[model samples]
Target: MYKFASTASIAAPSAQLTLSGSGVFIFQIGSALGTSLNSQIVLVNGALPQCVFWLIGSSAVLGSGCKFQGILMASASIGFMDGASLVGAAYAQNAAVTLINSVITVPPACNL
Candidate 1:
């Protein structure tokens, strides 16, 4: 049987970008931001759609992004910021996906 645990914070950001578009292209695209942090989600092994984690909660969207506009119809990892974007149903054998964002905001004290 599978167990539920803190299972490392994926630490990997699914998507990060400097906004630059219209409506959402203006303010949100210029400097708006949002984030997703899931806790104790489901993780499975073997086969596609292997891990089934649900969107527990998300930071409000301040941009005119594609929340209700329906994502670009597909089954892969859509990086459009839609609530339905797929990060992974990732297989165990596939190469690791590395996401490195240089603009990380560390707390002031952590700047030591």
Candidate 2:
């Protein structure tokens, strides 16, 4: 499990990120606490088409027009900006989920 007790963002325009297996990536709001500036996972190339993002923050924000794949689980609210799309599921445990012109497609249920 990867834990971050402060604000974190995957804002690298040219970076690749893949979270899989039983691993959990946790994020807790830091200096920018109590605002909409929670943890952010930006869209970028080179990322795996199928994975998971476990956000343990006050909130989770997806970049606009992002094409992301995986099961995104957040501890609080989840915001999907305009044009952002997800090829998986998203769960917000303790707050309302807001989406603006976003797409969410759940993969076909199957067992290996």
Candidate 3:
């Protein structure tokens, strides 16, 4: 269950995002310089395709049981926990990624 009030960019570098439990995931990306807030919300679903990578500016949060199939890029920081899994690389350009015993893998393509 994810809802977005502000404006931001929503891009799934490789895969698509799927919602669960009648929830909607809203992501508004590539807005004006400072007219909008760069924020994105994602809902967790077992039937959803794995996320390849996310290019975020401010912040990004993932549900507990969610799974990502690629890299995660953020300008500020990224937070995830409770059995969340990232199968690719994670790059916080100007911040850090917070995780709690989560799974992470760096794919070869990420190097390029």
Candidate 4:
């Protein structure tokens, strides 16, 4: 239902984030053009746990497939509280990223 990649910034000192409320946000690489078709904020510019994230250009939030029955797409400057909430949260993935706790997963699919 959506596709694209962008370089998101989430400020400094802060280290955590929450892509909840139903959405899909990632920081792979490249501009967020032609890739943002349906997203609340197709191109996220938030901190990454231990990095500095900032709004270098736009901040009006861009997207097409944003609001829906089941779709969360945005990034927010967060802290450790958001990260701790991840613990004990159900996970699922046909693939692996790191260890058991570092894999990409959706929060309990619907709840936790």
Best by TM-score: 2
Q: Scored by CA lDDT, what does every candidate get?
A: 0.21, 0.57, 0.47, 0.24
Model 3, range 22-81, lDDT digits (tens) per residue? 222223333111111222233455322233344555665554555654455667667665
TM-score (all chains, Cα) for each model: 0.17, 0.61, 0.52, 0.21
Question: lDDT: which candidate is best?
Answer: 2
Please give the RMSD to the true structure for each candidate, in Å: 18.5, 5.8, 10.1, 14.2
Tens digits of per-residue lDDT for model 4, 1-112: 2222455433223222344333333333232211132222121343122121222111212222221111212223111121122221221122211122122223233221
**Ranking of all predicted structures according to lDDT, beginning with the best and ending with the worst:** 2, 3, 4, 1
Q: Taking the tens digit of each residue's C-alpha lDDT, what string does model 1 give over 4-50?
A: 23221222243232222222111111121233432112212321121
Model 2: per-residue Cα lDDT at residue 55: 55
Q: Which residue runs of candidate 1 sit more than 4 Å off their true CA positions?
A: 6-8, 15-46, 50-83, 86-112
- Candidate 2, which ten residues in sequence have the lowest lDDT sum? 31-40
Name the 10 consecutive residues with the lowest summed lDDT in model 4. 77-86
Stretches of candidate 4 off by over 4 Å are 1-5, 15-96, 100-107
RMSD of 4: 14.2
**Which sequence of candidate numbers ranks them by TM-score, best first?**
2, 3, 4, 1
Error of 1 at 7 (Å): 6.8
Better of 2 and 3 by TM-score: 2
Model 1: colliding residue pairs: 19-29, 21-25, 22-25
